[model samples]
Target: MAVTCCSVCAIQQLVSPYSAELSNGMQMAFLFALFTSAFCREAAKECRRRKKEYIKCLESRVAVLEVQNKKLIEELETLKDICSSKTD
Candidate 1:
């Protein structure tokens, strides 16, 4: 199989010689452990990056909503004042 990334290439290099000395089952187990740990490390890094982006997006959205809310409240107060004057 083609090496997809630096991590895969590193794993293959690290395991090739050691794997040659092991039984088939041991080779599979060793490969699985190495690959799983690498994948977990990559996934966590990706999650953290995406989480930062999501937080920035949410903060911008909140800022916009706050502005809209303030405008709506002003409109509401104007309407209330008009209604009270008409009733009086």
Candidate 2:
């Protein structure tokens, strides 16, 4: 009976530490997941900010191109008048 008691105590001791280690591992995994989620959220916010800036830049470029096209059209009209006068 004494030997059985000693074996049971030894088994309990071993199992207790294994359970504690498993709990600690789960805690560490939870923390890692929390931090990774935060990092991804911040990355997504930055990408959105950059995309907004890119859209604004593209809008400005389009406006400038429209002005340039108008100027080209005006210059073409003037050239056409000059050519017609020369022909006359």
Number of the top lDDT candidate: 1
Where is the poorest 10-residue window by lDDT in model 2?
A: 1-10
- Stretches off by above 4 angstroms in model 1 are 1-8, 16-21
Off by over 4 Å in 2: 1-22
C-alpha RMSD of candidate 1? 3.0
lDDT of 1 at 25: 89
- In candidate 2, the residue pairs with backbone N, CA or C atoms under 3 Å apart (3 or more residues apart, or in different chains) clash, namely none
lDDT of 1: 0.86
- Give each prediction's root-mean-square deviation over alpha carbons: 3.0, 15.7
What's the C-alpha lDDT at position 55 in model 2?
A: 100
lDDT of 1 by residue, 1-76 (tens): 2237886777768878887688888877887898888778888999999999999999999999999999999999
Taking all chains together, each candidate's TM-score versus the true structure is 0.71, 0.73
Error of 2 at 13 (Å): 30
Give residue 55's error in model 1 in angstroms: 2.3
TM-score of the candidate numbered 2? 0.73
